[model samples]
Target: MLSRAARPALRAGAAASSRAAAPAATFATLREIEGRLKSIRNIEKITKTMKIVASTKLNRAQRAMTESRSYGETSNKVYQSAETKPLEGEGKKKLVVVCSSDKGLCGGVHSGLARFIRRRAATEGDNFDLVILGEKAKAQLSRTHAKNIVLNFSGVGKDVPTFTEAQSIVDQIVQLQGDYSEVEILYNKFINATSYEPTIIEGFSEEAFANSPNFAAFEVEEGVLPNLREYTLANSLYWALAEGHACEISARRNAMDNASKNAGEMISKYQILFNRTRQAVITGELVEIITGATASADM
Candidate 1:
């Protein structure tokens, strides 16, 4: 099989085959890179869209939060003016209402509330019953403090919260009628566009409010106290929901913004690698062509 002249021709054919296979392999890699690039581009688009939506919602959420604050503040004055405090020395427990949302994608918005509760549980030694206002916190707190949950509500925090929603929640809370000394509404407080913290608003029981040291100054009727308590509960819940919504929107916008930035960085990096790889493939093809032409001329 080794006649000298035929051997050279066979070697040339084999070399051409090898060169063709190399280009095929390089093309396969190029296609893979292209697929990855497309996927990343799609993700970037989605994140950017989410950021825009959150930005739009942030303004409305802030407005709702601002409006609700007045209601809570005005209602709280009744207790503050009378110097009200939670009942003590009765072996009583407090009820904690955790205001979280059904939705996620905000940075630690739900987890922040959960963490706060866990910390309180650790320090307070489970002397409180939890009334979860959203599915998100319920799922989390249920794991460790499941026994402490007396009542939990769902289908909340989808949009800017309404007073009707707050009233409904307050109604359920009032109906619970547990032996709680006081109630606490917990929510994420909006510190700024980029910062938030867990905060609580204290709520006094009817007995506690009535027994205030300065209670005699107001001349309030016993019949009005029940209504006042319910109204105050509603007001506090509305405030918590609104402020938590604002915090969530702001955090989500920031999260999406960061995601988009990271995706852009990845896209830029991949683009450079793709361009270099493509140039390499072209150079390889040109080399193969030049080699073939030179071999033919030699023949």
Candidate 2:
């Protein structure tokens, strides 16, 4: 019922009013985007920091692993050259010493060992007792292999493991009364900076070492056999611990690096969305203002 000149004014005013409601919804969306952006930024920071820490530790761990490997191999050469083997049919159970770490965020380092033990248990039966070196493995293995755990040491692998620590652990293990035919030191073997696998270093019992087909060739002293056995056990344990620590650090660095990249990607997406939303809000406000001005002019 309005005249031609007033009709344009009324239409413009109605259009402006309709658009006025849009800012509220847009504001809510903007807030959510901002909140998400902040969270992603925080996550990126944390992951970056973790990556740095792991990188710092990786160098020292690798060095220690190298030294330990040399020492362990040297110590075991006598048994290897003597053609020693674990005595079977001796009516004794096997002992598996699991070397892992107390910490986590290392991407399957601990879980891999747990899975290996579980698979062994499933296929070979639970005839072995577990000596866990880390809480992470203990927690994972304890669910099913609780009764088989003989000794557990926590707070291990916090740093480069020393020979003294390994010797102390050996002292405790020797104190255990179980009659084990074979003592296997299970640990993560570092194949490279990026890959590792669970492996075992065999610890020959004193009887197995002495009864070797070629042991008589070495001319070892009468009382030196026991000392050699215990010394070799400690050396093997140190090697396993050092290698496992290196693998864990490498794995953690890779994991944190991936996490930081992913977080950065998320942050970029949210930032783009936030900027576009803000521009849209500004455009919307400008449109409302222009429309209102046009309506007044028409009136």
- Candidate 1 stretches with Cα past 4 Å from truth are none
1-299 in candidate 2: lDDT tens per residue? Answer: 77887777677768867786889899999999999999889989999999999999999999999999887999889888999998888558999999998999999999999999999999989999999999999999999999999999998988899999999999999888888898999999999989999998999888888899998899987699888889999999999999999999999999999999999999888899999999999998998788677767857
Candidate that scores best on TM-score: 1
Tens digits of per-residue lDDT for model 1, 142-162? 999999999998988888998
Candidate 2 TM-score, true structure as reference: 0.88
| Per-residue lDDT of 63 in model 2 | 92
Q: What would you estimate as the lDDT of candidate 2?
A: 0.92
> What is candidate 1's local distance difference test score?
0.93
Residue 154 accuracy (lDDT) in model 1: 90
What would the TM-score be for candidate 1 when compared with the true structure?
Answer: 0.94
